[model samples]
Every structure is written in structure tokens, then in C-alpha cells.
Target chain A: MIEIHDLHYRVGAAPILSDISLSLPEGSLTALIGPNGAGKSTLLRLMARLEPLQSGRITVEGLDLATTPTDAMARTLAIMGQQNSVASRLRVRELVGFGRWPHHQGRPRAADREAVEAAIDAFGLQPFAGRFLDELSGGQVQRAFLAMTFAQDTAWMLLDEPLNNLDVAHARALMARLAQLVQDTGRSVVAVVHEVNYAAAWADHVVAMKHGRIVAQGAAEAVLTEDLLSDLYDTPVEVSRHDGRPLVLHHHSHSRIADLSRGRLPDRARLS
Target chain B: MRFAAGLGLAALLALMLVSLGVGAAEISVRQARSDAWTMLVLMESRLPRTLAVALAGAALAVSGTLIQSLVRNRFVGPDTTGTSESAALGLLAVTILAPASPIWVKMVAASFAAMAGTALFIVVIRRLPRREVMLVPIAGLVLSGVLGSIVTWIAWQADLLQYVGVWMSGEFSGVTAGRYELLWVAGLAAGLAWVGADRFAILSLGDGVATGLGLSTASVMRFGLVVVAVVSALVVTTVGMVPFLGLVVPNIVARVMGDNLRASLPVVAASGAGLLLACDIIGRLLIAPYEMPVSVILGVLGALIFLVLLYRRPAHA
Candidate 1:
């Protein structure tokens, strides 16, 4: 379990994340959902130790984040942020091989090479392993980065917006892969997802934030109700059941005139 | 791989011999072997100059590769980091303070100052808001230019401008057997960097990734910066400022061979030696009795090549 208490972050004079306290259970897939400027990325960064803790304490599996050695933490948790921007000249395989650096330092043993190859195979990236990152398309590059993170082989994988720049098929594939990893290996996964439907479909737990504070967090079905969805986004939304999951509908307005024209309103709406 | 490296080694040895053989005195290979005095002269004068060129060439190129890899920026180099300029300033200060100071003393002072300057550049970069890598080099270039102007002004005021000019012009004319020993420090530094090449490559992947991989990014960066400063300062003390040698050689090598530091390092070293040796030969032949500074020739060539590279789409970041 990862526990955060009274986590606060400020940049200059403005606060980014404030008084955030939460416990992430192990062996679960959690999705962080929020509006723009909701501090979702900041929270994720803090959890991953990308940013130092300002006022609170974070512990991963009973080990203190601030006091534990970085290598030890690395072995336990892996994080992939939104911005990649890796040197494009590096080949896909070489980039993935870096995941084994903690284990092998500089010299790669047989196990390291085997792990890298398995990661490549797992991501279905064997065909493009030798190719440079620049040569790959956006979605392909995303998969390569994901492969690199997976090759890290940590118990906890914290991904900040991993689905950005992926096409619909690629996005679904990535989600499916994450789901499979959680189910098969019992690995803990936390992803900051922008699309509600993705979280609705795959997330076991959903945490909602607004204005740098957690507003709601629980099981996906509990926190994803119509009232919470409309309040979270400040827009009216209709929730319907599909495949025993919530399908959010927020696209069109439910105007009385449209309803009357469609002959789906009462006599009062038709007369008006 | 061994064969290719061996060929490079052979080419480097041949260039070294050719460089030592041709000079203003025109000592023939046969004549030098026949007389003891001539042999001593050849060994004492030409050999040192050849070694200086080869060592300084390799040092600058290796340092350049380290700096570029550490910052993950192609345009970065020792000169751009203000290291050479700082060394020049340190040498000038020694000349003005103790006009009769030993060359070794001056070199030590310069190395210390150069290291300090590189440390300053790294600290400034670390304090920034973390933008693109290109900004780091640009900032370093501006800092170097500022430091260089200060050194020039001070040299002029001290009336030691002539001494400073000779040292700043990047020439191998002053090299002799005993005086060129300072360059051995550069050679040692290059060796140290080669041994740590893997750590440097890992650090180049950005601090977060390196930290995630259990490497101390700050420690690795400090080591890299020290290597760059030491090699650059020692070379500046021995042969003056050679422009673009560090920047152009590593970049060209990376383009041709790829960014695998283990593979590209030796190539960068060889290419650096070849470039400097060829430039030095041309510098000797163009003026014959009166030698043009190798720095001027290299600066012009390096600038042209750098511009060409800028126009071509970069294959990697």
C-alpha cells in the first residue's frame, strides 16, 4: 500500500496541491480523473517521487519515500510521465534496455537481456526493436515507451496520461494490456485518465479531484454516478447502463422543444 | 570491430609520424637517423608536438562527447561551457601576477579555474525551470563570450597581451619535450571518461530516468563536468584554444556510427586527431615559415560545418 498524508505543494506563491491525503491499496487498478488544473498530474508526480514532498509524508509498502534509497524505490515502483521527449537517435531496443540498468548497472548479463527481449515480445515490438524512435509513428512510440516501463518490472506502475497521442485502437490496446497485467500478475497500476469512458470501462477504483483536493474516491460504480459526474465537470450529464457499466452521455442538450418535435414529451411540452 | 579500430589506430600512428617529420627545419627521415644530434632534435621537438596534437585532439573530442551526452544536447561542448575561456583567464592571471611563473604552476591554476567555471554552468542549468536542452548551450555560449571578453580586456591592461595572444591562438609551435607533459593530464582524464562511458550514457536519458535506474544523477554530472574541465584546460594550456574540435568531431561520429558511446567514443577520438592533424599540416604549409594559428583555420571550418549540420534535419535529439 502507498499512503500519502497532508501532502501539499506550492509553486512560488500559488498552491498546486493542498492537504491531499489518500491511501492506495495494492493489487488494484486506480484511475485519477479530474478537470483541467485539478492537480492530477502533480499528485501523480508526487506519488512517483518526481517531485519532492513539500509538507507531508509518503510511504510505499511501509518504506518512507524521503528516506529510502532511490534504487530501492526504483525496484518497487516504476513511473512513466506524460512528456517523453527522449533522444530520438536511440533505437527502440536500446531505450528499452535501459530499464535493466538498475539491475545490471552498465554490463548486461543474460537475465537482463532476457528481460528486455520479453518486454519487447510482450509489447509486440519485436518488429521495430532495431528501429530508431523517430522512425516510429506516435502510437508506436507510445507502445515502445510503455514497453520500457514494463521492462522495469516493478510492483507498482504509475502512469501519468499514458493514453495521450494514442489512436482509438492503440488506446484500447494499451488499456487492455494494463488490465491484463493487473489481473494476471496482481501488479498495482495507477493511471491519470482524461477520458471518463476508459476509467468507466477498466478502472476498479476511481478518484475524482477538483481544485487540488480530492472530492470523491471509491469504487468505480460508487463515484461515477450521474450527480457526481455533473458536479465534477459543472455540466449536466445523463448516465445509462450498458454492459453493466455506466455510459456517460453529455453531448446533446435535453431541450423541451426538441423533445416535443420528437413526440417524446407530455401534452404540456407539445402545447408550449 | 577490432580490425576497424586497429585500422584507425594505424592511421593515427601514420599521421603522428608524418606530422613529426614535416616542419620548418625540414629534417629528413634518413638524415635524422644518421646523426645523434639530429635524432635528439627530432625526438625532443617533433615528437612532443605530434603527441601534443594527438593527445589534445583526443582529449577535446572525448570531453565534447561527455558534455553533449550529459546535457543531451548536440551543440554543447567544453568551449561552449566557458571551460576553455576560464582556463585562458586563469593563465592570463598567472602571467600578470607572476610573470616568471612555471608553466606547470600556470596549468594547475588554469585547470582549477576551468573546473570552477564548468561547475558554475552546471549549477545555473540545474536552477533553471527545466526547458529544452538547447537553452542550456545557448546560455553557456553567452557566459563564455562574457568571460572571454573579460580575459581579453585584462590581458590588454596588464601589457601581457603578447604572451596571452600566443597562448590563446591555438598553435602547436611552442610544444617541446618537457613543456607538453601538461597534456598527459588530459589523456588521463579521457581514460577516466571512457571507463565511465556507460554511466554518462544512462545519465543522458534525463535525470528522472537515471534516478529511476538507481544512478545518482548529480554525482554523474559532477564527474562529467570535472572531466570536461580538466581536459579542456590542459589542452588550452598546451596548444591554445582549438575551436569546434570538441563539438564537430563527436557530432559527426554520432551521425555516422550512432550514439552508442562505447562505439562512437573511439571514432570521435580518432576523428578528432585526424582533423587537428590535418588542420595543423595545412596551417604549416599555408604560411610555411610564418604559421597561421590553427584556431583560426579550425574556427572557420568548424563554423561552416556546424551551419551545414544545423540545416540538415537532425537524425536524433
Candidate 2:
């Protein structure tokens, strides 16, 4: 379980996060959904302790982030940011091997090597194991990073926009793998997801943010209503059920254009 | 990799022997006449100078690799951080304050001043918004300018300008058994670098990942700064400013072998020694007794290579 209390983050004069307090249930695959500039990434980064906390307290399990040692925190929680570029040109396997660094520090034992190989196999990266990161496609790179995060073998995984540039099929595959991890391994996950449908399909819980605060958070079904999403994005939307999950309908601007064609009618007629 | 390293070492050994023979002394290479004069020249001048060149080259190259990795910048080196200039200032202060001080005092002062300069550079870098990778080296160059000018102005006023540019324009002509001993300390810094190679590689990945991986990014960066300062200061104190030796050597090594320091650091050291020794040879042979500074040749060659590196940046880069 991860708990954040009275978290207020300010960047210069602008308030990035304002007294945002929330508790993420343990072993739940949670989705963080918000419009642009809603501070979704900031909240994730703050929880991960990637950014220093200004006025807040975060705890993973029973350990407080403020007082816990970095190595201790690393053992329990692993976070991956959107753009994790390696200045060193490393192969996929080598990059994944670094995930065991916290465990072995540098010297890899037989177990560590096994974990690295398992991570590669887990991500279906065996074919590209020897390929440099630059040689992989964007989706492949994202999967490679995911493999590294998995290789950490922590209780919780915190990801900020892991599906950022991945295509629909790749994104689905990643979410499915994440779902599998949560179900089979009981690893808690908190991801900043852009495509609301993916969140609705995979996330057991959803936290909606707006204007630097949690607008709503609960079981995925309870919080992902049409009214909530429409208000969250400030755009008209519809939510309909698909395969027993909420499917967000956001492509409505064309309907307005069609309504304009509702035949008041002959002001501009085509050749037809 | 082992084969390449062995080849490099063998070539280096052959070159060391040739360098020993090519000096101003008329020592015969013939095995029959190993007389006192020949022994004296080899021990007192040729051997020490050659060893000093090797030490300085390896130290500076390791220093360059450390800085570039820590900063995550391809263009960064010890010079970019004003480390050498600050060290030069330290040496200048010692020269003026106590002209009779031993070489150890001067070396200590230079390294201390260099560490201070690097600390200030870190503070400045932290305060500024990090929008560009190029900004770091530019900031370092500017800081070097300011620090270097202070040394110049003071040296000029005191009429002790003779000591101002000791190692900046590198030459092996002045190296002898006693004068170049500080370079061994620089060699120690290189060994420390080798031992800490994994820490550097992890830190090079970036702050967030490094932190996430439980490594203290700040301390690792501090370690890198100290290594850079110590190596550059030692080299500068012993040999003067060897411009671009650090920048050019480490980069060429990284191009041939990737930045996994554990695997590549020894190679980097060898490449650095080979390149510097080669440059020194060219400088010596070009004018013979007249002697051009090795720095001059490296400055020209490094600039050309740098341009090529910039234009031919990897497609993924």
C-alpha cells in the first residue's frame, strides 16, 4: 500500500499539487487519468520520490518516504518514468541487467543472472536481447524498459505514462502484461494512462485528477462515469458499456458538424 | 577486446623504446656499449619523461571519461569544468606565496583549488535550468576564463609570469626523474576510477534511474568531480596544460569501445598514452631541438576530430 497525505507541491510561484491526499490500496492495478496540465505526472513523480517533497508525507507499506533510506525504498517500490534515456549505448539485455543493481550493487551472482534472463523472457525480448536500445522500435524500447522495471522484483511498480508513444496493439499488450503481473504475482501497480479505454479495461481502480487535486478515486466502475470524465476534460463525452467495462466515447465533434448539416439546409449544397 | 588491448600495449612498449632512443643524448642503441653516460641518460631523463607521459595520458583520459559519464554530455571534459584552470591558479598562489615551497605543497594546493572550482561548478549547474547538454561545457569554459584571468593578472603584477603556463602547453622536454613524480599520484587516481567504474556507469544512466536503483547520485557525482580534479591537477602540475588530451582521447576510445568503463577503461588509458606519446613524438620530430609544444599539435588535431565527431554524430544520437 502507498499512502500520500497533505501533499502540496509548488514550482516557483505556481502550485503544481495542492494538498492532494490519497491512499492507494495494496495489490491493486490503479490508473491515474487526467487532462493535460492536471499534474498527473507530478503526483506520480512525487510519490516515487524522484522529485523532493515540499509539504507531504508518503509511505510505502509501513516505511515513510521522507525518512526511509533510498536503498530501502528501492527494495519495495520501483518506478519508471516516461523518457528513460541511457547516455551509454547499452544492449537490451545489459539495460535489463542493471535492474538487479540494487540487489547485487555490481557483482552479479547466478541468481541475478537468472533474474535478468527471466526478465528478458518475460518481456518477449529474447530476440532483441543483444540489440542496442537505438536499434529497437519505440514499442520495443518501451517493453525493454518495462522488462527492467519488472526485473527489479519489487512489491510495487510506479509508472508515469508507460504507454506514451506505443501503438494501440502494443499498448494493449503492455496493459495485458501488467494485468497478468498484478493478478498472478500480486504486485501493486500505479500507472499514468492516457487512453481512458485502456484504463477502463485493465485498471482495478482509477484516480482522476483536475487542477492539482484528486477529483475522484475509487473502484474503476464507480469513478469512470460520463459526467465525471466530461467535467474532467471540459468536453462532452459519452460512456457506454463494452464487454462489461466502460468504453469512453470522445469522438463527438464530427456529430456537431453533422448537426450543422441538419438541413436548415441548402445554404451550401454540394454537387450531389 | 583482449587482443586489441594486447596489441595496443605491445605497440606502446615498442614506441617507449623508440622514444628513449630519439632524444638529444647520443646514447647508442647497440647492446655492446651500455656505459655510464648511456645509463645516466636513460634513467635520469628518457625513462622518467616517458613514464610521466604515460601516467599523465592515462590519468587525464580516465578523468575525461569520468566527467563525460557523470554529466551525461559527450562534449564535457575536465577543461569544460574549469578544473585545470583552478588547479593552475592554486599552483600560481603557491608559487607567489612561497616560492621555495616543495613540489608536494604545490600539488596539494592545485588539487584543493581544483576541487573547490568543481564544487562551484556543481552549484552553478544545479541552480541553472538544464535546457541543453551543451550548456555545461560552456559554463565550465566561462568559469575557466574567469579563474585563468585571475592567475594571469596576479602572475603579471608579481613579475612571476614564467610559472603561469607550466603545463598548459605540454612538452616532455623538461620531464626528469624528480620533476615528474606527482604524475604517479595521477596514476593512482586512474586506478581508483577503475575500481569505481560500475558506480560511474550506473550514475551515467541519469539521476532518476540511478536513484531508483538505490545509488546515491549526488555522492557518485562528487566522486567523479574529485577524480577529475585530482587527475587534471596532477597532470597540469607536472606537465603543463595538455589541451584537449582528455577530450580527444576518451571520446576516440568510447567510439571504438562503448562506455562500459569496466570493460573499456584500460583500453581508454592505453589509447590516451598512445595518442599523447604520438603527439609528443610529432612535436619533438617536427622541429627537433627547437621543439614545438605537444599542446599545439593536439589542439589542431582535436579540433578537426571534434568537428568530425559533431558532423558525423550517430544517427540514433
Pairs of residues at least 3 apart in sequence or in different chains that clash in candidate 1: none
Per-residue alpha-carbon lDDT of model 2 for B1-317, expressed as tens digits? 67876888999888777777776666765642558778888889888988998888888888989988877767767876788888998998898899899888998999999999888877777666655656777888898889888888998999877778655567778998998998898999888989888888877777878888888888888888888888988888888888787887777877766677887788888878878888777777887766777788888987888778878765444
**Highest-lDDT candidate:** 2
What candidate 1 gets wrong by more than 4 Å, as runs, is: A252-272, B1-6, B30-34, B98-104, B123-136
Q: In candidate 2 chain B, where is summed lDDT lowest over 10 consecutive residues? A: B25-34
In order, the TM-score of chain B in each prediction is 0.93, 0.94
Interface RMSD of each: 2.0, 1.6
lDDT of 1 at A198: 84
TM of chain B vs. native, candidate 1: 0.93
Q: A1-272 in candidate 2: lDDT tens per residue?
A: 89899999999999989989899998889999999899999999998889998997999998999899999888898888876455576678888988988898779899999999999998899999988776788889888888888999999999989998888898999999899889988999999998898999999999999999899999999999977997898765567778899887764456543543342322222311
Error of 1 at A134 (Å): 2.5
Candidate 1 docks with a DockQ of: 0.45
What range of 10 consecutive residues in model 1 chain B has the weakest lDDT sum?
Answer: B308-317
